[model samples]
Target: MPSHGAWLKVGGAMARVIHVFRHPDRFVSGTVGEPGERTFYLQASSESKQVSVTLEKQQLTVLSERLTSLLEEVASRFDTEVPPSAPEELTDTDPLDVPVEEEFRVGTMGLGWDAESSSVVIELLAITEGEVDENIVLDDTEEGPDAVRVFLSPAHARAFAERAERVINAGRKPCPLCDEPLDPEGHICPRQNGFLRDNPFTEG
Candidate 1:
């Protein structure tokens, strides 16, 4: 068991839980507090990208031991291993085009409490409506094969909504009515009222 002193303060914020985790990076597993405030840190020599778990004083004594064992189990499934700082073999490959990302539906919603900041973040919205605060909102819709609906964290979701006013300013000129690339010269869009389709895409 960890000692009572293992628990530490994160910041000045008197968050109810103790702290909160934000900007959930690709390199860390997310965790939050249950009842009391807790600290978080990286386990040395661990193969995980980064893991955030509560650090209570009581768990301090056995923290490394318990974490190591648990990390091993997780390592088997993901990339977790202790190896040389630099790999024996490394290579340089040609520049590949941008990777295409397929659209995926968020079938479920997840909630994680941040013990550091004492705030909560919501993820993966599936239900049309959840018993959450009015300050939070999530709405997703399936438009078509070429378009998708995205719900943001409200802090930064306004930059790219697929509304008419937004589309005009966005430089995303592909007509929704016509897959045909919008050309000011005159497009085949029925909505264009016979506007000419002028495309800069030239072929050799």
Candidate 2:
């Protein structure tokens, strides 16, 4: 079993620490807290090692959308047989794993398809106060920010994206007129000149 954490050395100094899950048993996106106040997370586990990283809701949404698009491109360009949707049996709806201690806040994410393994590779780098090096986003460089790397099968990738979409939509209802999230009390629609309007789409 690989260590839960691995450190790299750069120029006689400690470099970034990376957690790599070559064949994760499970990987999914989840959240903690209520709809409007949710904190999104991406969790991956294999055997005894479980890692969770925090990201913005919009980031998760983009990741899900890009995963689908990447699969489509793979199928079209490489003649790969990618599933149109995740298999029902593999659908995961469980909450985030226990002890969801965030290792880091993700600042940069990288996604790619590994042809040799026929897997989707997702890399998440820790947020830095300064600008990030573009090469470190995906490359295995000794000097870079901490990162979590998970390689998923096409089926698992599809499942992850599907679950992510569901989690994102489970948030607060959006205002029909302005497309903004509606408060529990009601939404003041800017489009309607700050007038409070009842959202027909949301059930009372």
Clashes of 1: 28
Candidate 1, residue 189: lDDT: 65
Candidate 1 per-residue C-alpha lDDT over 1-204 given as tens digits, one digit per residue, 9 for 90 to 100: 111111223365321111112332211111122212322221111222222222333333232234334333433554434222213222112121123121222233333332333323333322234453322322211211111112122121111111212222223356666765454444666667766656553211
TM-score of each: 0.18, 0.82
lDDT for residue 200 in candidate 2, whole number 0-100: 49
> What are the runs in model 2 whose C-alpha is more than 4 Å off?
1-5, 11-13, 174-204
What is the alpha-carbon lDDT of model 2 when measured against the actual structure? 0.85
The stretch of ten residues in a row with the least summed lDDT in candidate 2 is: 195-204
Q: Candidate 1, after superposition: displacement of residue 61 in Å?
A: 1.9
True-structure lDDT of candidate 1: 0.27
Position 74, candidate 1: lDDT: 37
What lDDT tens digits, residue by residue, belong to model 2 across residues 165-196?
88887776878788886755677999999999
- Model 1 off-target regions past 4 Å? 1-15, 21-58, 80-204
